[model samples]
Target: MTLPDGGQSPDALRSGTGGGSWDGERSGRGLSEREPFDLLVTGGRVIDPASGRDEIAAVGIRAGSIAYVGPVPDRAAAYSRRTIDATGQVVAPGFIDLHSHAQTISGGRLQALDGVTTALELEGGALPVADHYRYAEDQGRVINFGMSASWSSARMCVLDQAPAVRPQDDPRFRLPLAMFDQFQNGPRWQSAADDAQESKIVGLVERQIAAGAIGIGVLQGYAPGSRLSEQHLLGRLAEQVGQPLFVHARSMAPAGPGNAVDAAHELIDTAELTGAHVHLCHLNSTSGRRADRVTTDWATAQRSGLRLTAEAYPFHAGSTVIGAAFLDPEVLARDGISTRSVIYLATGERVADADRLLELRETDPGALCILETFDLDDPQQLALLLTAVTFGDAAIASDAMPLTYTGPAPRSGTDHSERALAALTGDVWPLPDGLIAHLRTSGCFARALRWLVRDLGVLDLVEVIRRCTILPATILAAAAPAMQRKGRLSVGADADLTIFDPDRVQPAGDYTRLAPSIGFSHVIVAGTPVVDGGDLVPDAFPGRAIRGSAG
Candidate 1:
């Protein structure tokens, strides 16, 4: 029998290696004379980035692991179980999101329609990693999920004395939108940590890592006035634990001491000094119009043997809470960010002036807003954004924000006190109208395929698939070896696959009407098909937890 990578030799007719069971954690059983194949996908072009093979093939699955991939002569008759006729589709490894904040069942459903099988919260991760995992397990996710150890969450837990629990745990608890907004006027956001306080914060993060956080999430950009010494210490901690530090660099000012360029250097310097794997998050919006220079600097550093990587979403605008440190009037003025460029999602109001912006910041510091950083119509600005998206081997992450319903809380089956956390992690399906989130939540991958490969011709389909799969999996391989089994289609790899029509796969979501992207025929997680024939399987929950080795 032939193997998954087109029978091991250049010719598909030749048989090089036989299929057998591997990786007991994910696989079910070995191929045997008595057992029948569980599922067979036939008549499609299989693109396996890990093996560098792209050809027409059939994939056989048994017990959640791929058992065989070759030219199936008998098609359905060879396998008595389930069969998928992917006649006009491309079967590729399911997209892996390296940075996502949509950790709810509703969010997972939206992402599944966009061809994602795994979505990780590495940029703004969760605190008390164990609790996060427990909650997700109890709720049952639609796709494989994980998170990093949130440094900002740990900081607030220590410095601001914020309650580190959901509203379910305490009557007075509230879900802070971002780091500095944990408290309306808290001084801890701007103050440096004392030696003891820094040690305490480090201990909290370390404990969470041991509890199964994939890495450390450094959201220093939200608290730009905070000291750098704490970040240096965190870098050292990540190196010691062999986990990468997912960093949102401090400050996005245009041309000052704490500009994006300086922040890029700081990350590179920290990687060099501490010997840690530092991941720069959201290079597109964070680097603003200077993406060309920032990407060049990072590429040079990477060539110099520094352990650094970056991710960027395709959109020119960014979504965050209104109280971000960079949204200060002076900083915005220096960067030429007009007040009109920012739109409040709750009220659908564009800030008329600096006074209105400050009033909103003071009154509803945790409100969500969208910042238009670039005009796609302008060729120069569009090219600047593309510079980051097309950077050498950079992963394309969604940076998907949490879904929110601006309407009043439901009167039945919902407690007034538990409204915030409930909506954040609820199983609300068929999301109600007036739900507000960035279009990236449901359209990032489809949009990337549409814009980068088909429209602009900047990259090929195979290269974009690599960025979505193997590259992101390789980035986290050191911390979570389980990822090595994901992001590819091979004999022993987990049966997580995305099958779609190249011409038809297009993002349907927009600012006014937020709809799920269409065109994925099937999305398999592990061995089960969560999306079958372009429809969601209501009962399929085959997602598994991805955790750090320290756990």
Candidate 2:
């Protein structure tokens, strides 16, 4: 990619009047008169997706906001607390994961290393939004966090069941996983809501939004008993509140009630009828071989002015609870997948037959199992799906799973403080086998960057950054204006950035051994260094909550 000017020199690119708004007064002696910056990043190829600026420039951060972005004059170097030489690196907005389930401390640490600064649960979101935020605040967070109000959780509450909440003393903080379990096997999962129950569920969702939920999360696949009328009601509620409705569509199978095409149709129809902005989660997994058609339909909806969008992970395999309604024998048969295709995450063993699959579902419904449905190993198919997402203007999200850990209670202070100390001292422990069994949880963005930009050469660096940053930011900012400050590098934007060597960045883990990606030189969150010199800053918790306008 050529710089906007005739030359590629840092001076030419920075001095030239291009995309970004330049502060001429702050360029020379004026910089010396201003307050010193908290941090200065110089000599990097700064790519701001929102402003369409991709060139070598210096960035100055002060008080957790971007203070300057332009050529660094000689005198400007004097006004900084710290300076980082970002030569041969790409400095862009830190990735924002819109569908992540990795809200725990360990999960945050791993995501930080992989260059994610913001991770939100938009699919199967938390119930009791206040409690979720309070728990995260009490425990401390390494990255910015937010969540939608879960319809599944509200349904459970309406049915008189305890909604999923991470026990305050539970070290792992796997409430999201527990929520999925509840949705999969609990009696309410297969019980349709009657007139009164539906009203209660809607009321609970309204309460959650009032408590600061980013939006409303609808996981229809796990709740087969839910009527289409229920979904429409939820859509109308979201529209009334001017918030997006994030949904895991009803099915992924090729035929029957779980067909991907039909599922897309239902979601699109809901959006059209209710005028709700709908976000389809995990298009690759939910749409399977028909993802292209779904993307086309989504495009048509967009042209029709229907508020619709979608997201997809890079991986081909998808994980879910064993007892999910969609996993019933008849449903599985319609999908043309058998038990032999299922791999247990806990033991790393494949389910041998239908009998064993049924046995596990009955015995341990909460255990996670991976289904190899997409054949992501085939580069061509992967590339095609990736192209579809890019063409469809869909954002890329990790859908990262939670990480588990076991250790003694913190010796002093809050749970977050102990974990921070452990991270700093190199004493933070991982689960015996691993926190998560899948590589996508830790390295989705890196893998996408490597395969899409470096290897396959299908997308340029700027385009990939746009999909990961500004695109998702724009989607969420419609409902939560606070997100407008994120996913950008313009002056006055939040100082959340990821610095990495483009040539060396790649994912290192796979199905067998989950590992963090490599080549993230530094990650800054809210103007604070969370990962300095490729190492996590112990006890650093600069993350703050991102709530919807309703809050």
Candidate 3:
């Protein structure tokens, strides 16, 4: 519930057992009740993709779920409630970000401001699942989130004891066997890997699932052949538990042998062997046929009745740690790629000379690099591919990184993070185009959807909304038992509708290679307006964590 000033209380909350909350709900000890729904949004084209309803409608919200959805209710006469005019607007279920590196679902607020109602965290899922639930409840969040287990994430916690964890080698992956092998055997503490490593890995993942992770996320790209057995085991366990696998298969760039096809099929093989659901992360990152092959394989498996799905972001270049092999001509040429095709991102120094890259790779393997591989194309073609691949089953993944917000603000002048500092002694830099094309400059959801509906002409309003809403809601519900009231535009669905001027809703994505970070206007979450017009309302963290199956 919302506090008087349109925020959640800082006090601890606890929900009782059976149909219990993902996190506990606090006793409304001292505060007066909120006005049920803060406002009523009416006169808009309401599109609930989950159920496929597209028409002019009115939505009533109370305690965060749609109190009514169809005919407009009296506003001035209906007690004390605010009224929102939605003429010429598009009212649809809020979006969902299927993949991200979130430690806790509470981090979903970043997405809510962008109209994302759900954020699913990947890797290592929710170790100590209780804490993840608490973070969401404590925030009185506007959006919802789900957990995914990461083999790499689990290893860092139960095994190493850190708040954060990534793959052994640069998990974001740049390819090359020498670099890839580290994830498999792991650089010994010389030899015997404590013998308990495998057990710990399994136990950690199992616990994350038990805690609340709905699925597994393997950045197979970085782990290479490292955790194959464990991943196979994870797949087995996920199947038994009915959780999907969110895999960042091998490599996305045209690098080495690890394009989307290679990594995805391998995971598919594991799915075949273990009997589980497998999802490919960021399908469009590769170019031309390689990207097509991934969707083809995914389709074949699904049609054959092997549960499989994939996710793709709207951006062209991907962001990973900045020290990957995209800089090495040897690696590039192998993929039929080149340096000119790669631009450095999240760093300040220019890329190193070929000789320097070899020197660095040999000397230091942990170096980071966020490369923007230039796979430039007609926006129309890009949208078409996304449409062809989604299969109406695919979900949208913002791939919106934490550093994008927590990283020094764009106006900070100079990068202050340690990673940025480290890359400086060497030549690394934030790609020029990234700061623009990524929608970092503005809100991103509309542009992402526009690519799907308008440019690609793949889907109309209904199907796209379904991908963002009911589809993700179903996924979240699979994780948290309390989320039955989420994702759809039903009477009981969470009142998380976004209302925007349809004509004015044209994409604001400034995707010219030089200006990626631009977006759109009007974002509402959980019956609350986190972004009015186009400004982020600070102190508005209304996100909730969604736990997974206990069975």
Question: Which candidate tops TM-score?
Answer: 1
> What clash pairs does model 1 have?
none
| lDDT tens digits, residue span 1-551, model 3 | 52221222233112322122222111212111344345667677878765566777766666766655565544422522776777677788777677654322223433554567666666324444445455446534445665666566455444445443222323232111112223332333112223468677777777767766677666555544454676677788878887787776655544345665667678879888998877777666543336666676777888877877766666665655433433455755666554444433334334556665555556544433344543346665555455434644776666654322224534444545544433211222332222222342123456555665777666666776666666655654554564556666655466666666544444343323232212324566676776665555555655666666663
Assess every candidate by TM-score.
0.91, 0.89, 0.74
Give a tens-digit lDDT track for model 1, residues 1-551: 33332222223212323334333112323334356668888889888787787888778788987877766545365463878888878999989998888777878888999999999988877776787787777768889999899888788878889767753454222222233345535658446788899999999999989999999988888877667778889889999999999999886766877788999999998999999999999999889878888999999999999999999998988988888777877779998899989888877778889999999889887777889999999999999999999999799899988765565646665544245435555655556665778899999999898889999999899998999998898898878877877887876678899999988898886765678888899999998898999988877888889998787
| Model 1, runs deviating above 4 Å | 1-33, 166-185, 408-424
The lDDT ranking, best first, is 1, 2, 3
Highest-scoring model, lDDT: 1
Q: For residues 299-385, what per-residue lDDT tens digits would candidate 2 score against the true structure?
A: 898999999988888777877777877776667777888777788776777898778888888988877777877666787667557
Of candidates 2 and 1, the better by lDDT = 1
User: Once model 1 is optimally superposed onto the true structure by TM-score, how far is the C-alpha of residue 140 displaced, in angstroms?
Assistant: 0.3
Write the number of the candidate with greater TM-score, choosing between 1 and 3: 1
Residue 497 of model 3 has an lDDT of 65
Better of 2 and 3 by TM-score: 2
Stretches of candidate 3 off by over 4 Å are 1-38, 74-80, 102-110, 123-142, 156-196, 251-259, 286-288, 324-330, 346-352, 356-370, 378-392, 404-444, 506-522
lDDT of 3 at 430: 35
